[model samples]
Target: MEIKLVKAIPGDVLLLHDVQTRAFQPLLEKYLDYEKNPANEPINRLFEKIQYSSFFKMVVDQKCVGGIRIVARNNSYWISPIFVLPEFQGKGIAQQAICQVEEIFTKHNIWELQTILEEQGNCYLYEKLGYERTDFEQVVNDRMTLVGYRKIKN
Candidate 1:
């Protein structure tokens, strides 16, 4: 399977929104009450974020199966939301996307991301890709707990 990372444009806002919603539907169903999920964001809000962040489409064999959004803060790259369509989860597309971002954002000395504490798969994926879980977490309401991770370049 071939994977590629491409910069996203304004035209992809709706596509990204759809991917985000479809990918997180299972999590929403599992938790049954996660209002803080990225998939819960409105399309207009996604458009606003796309305007400022480095948005990328995770393309596989010429199809878009996922996307990631990275933002800059205090010289560190923050990968806020990375979504892979449920159908595409087993593949290594998301990992490839993360590697691509590491290459693309080479100027940054540090990278960070956050995810729901219960998402073992996401936590494993980030850790395998060199991110270290920080000793910080937040209780997002009763149904959700957020965990943070960071990777610093040597």
Candidate 2:
């Protein structure tokens, strides 16, 4: 469906914020009692960080279907907060964004990549995508847990 990765622009801040809010709403309510607080520090941090990080939004058919945040650290790249709209799920949009990141990582000589998945199904998805789960931690206030995964760049 014509997927492509476009670098984040100043104009995309609000769109990214909307996508982040929509994609995480259910999970936040279920796991963290989060009620879409607009003044959330984490969201603010995401916006501030995006200005200097390798951020990209996945566009499909001229619409922003998904997005990813990749940061360079210690000579490796770590991807986080990859999100695809609920309606767009199961269509390989997340995978395409990740694969694009892998290509960039490899091109730039990045030797490792890591991310955290807070759901079991998502953990399996990461495993299927070649990420090896290293450890998991249970969140004290919720039934959910966090899983960490890493992949050595090829």
Candidate 3:
């Protein structure tokens, strides 16, 4: 399958919103109030928040299949809400998206990457890509766990 990472377009916001909500539905259902009331946040609000991020990227074939948002803080880049459509999972869409985002971060001399995940498999993916666990954990929603990771280099 052909894949390309591109700067997000205005029209792509709604698509990303759908992908994120679906891709993360299982996890969010157990941990977020928004899951109880999906109707609350306007799609435009989601778009605006993503648009304001310094590092926002999307992967597309004919349309957005996955995306990632990053923010720079304290010399480290924080990756949030990386998601691939449920139908596209295990097709390497997420791995490619992460690599593309990391390339941009590296070009800016941002060598450290940070993220939090709730699953061991997610942690394994990051570990295989050279991320180290800082042994930090936080409980959100009183029912879900967040495990933090940091990568110092490519």
Top model number, lDDT = 1
TM-score of 3: 0.78
lDDT of 2 by residue, 46-120 (tens): 677679898898899889877788878776677766777778877888877887788776644542333334566
TM-score of each: 0.93, 0.82, 0.78
lDDT per prediction? 0.86, 0.69, 0.66
lDDT of 1 at 80: 75
Candidate structures ordered by TM-score, highest first:
1, 2, 3
lDDT of 1 by residue, 46-107 (tens): 88888878888888878889889899898899997899999989788888888888888878
Best by TM-score: 1
Looking at candidate 1, the ten consecutive residues that score lowest on lDDT are: 30-39
lDDT of 3 at 49: 61
For model 1, how big is the CA root-mean-square deviation? 1.4
Better by lDDT, candidate 2 or 1: 1
lDDT assessment of candidate 1: 0.86
Query: Which segments of candidate 1 are over 4 A away from where they belong?
Result: none
Pairs of colliding residues, candidate 2: none
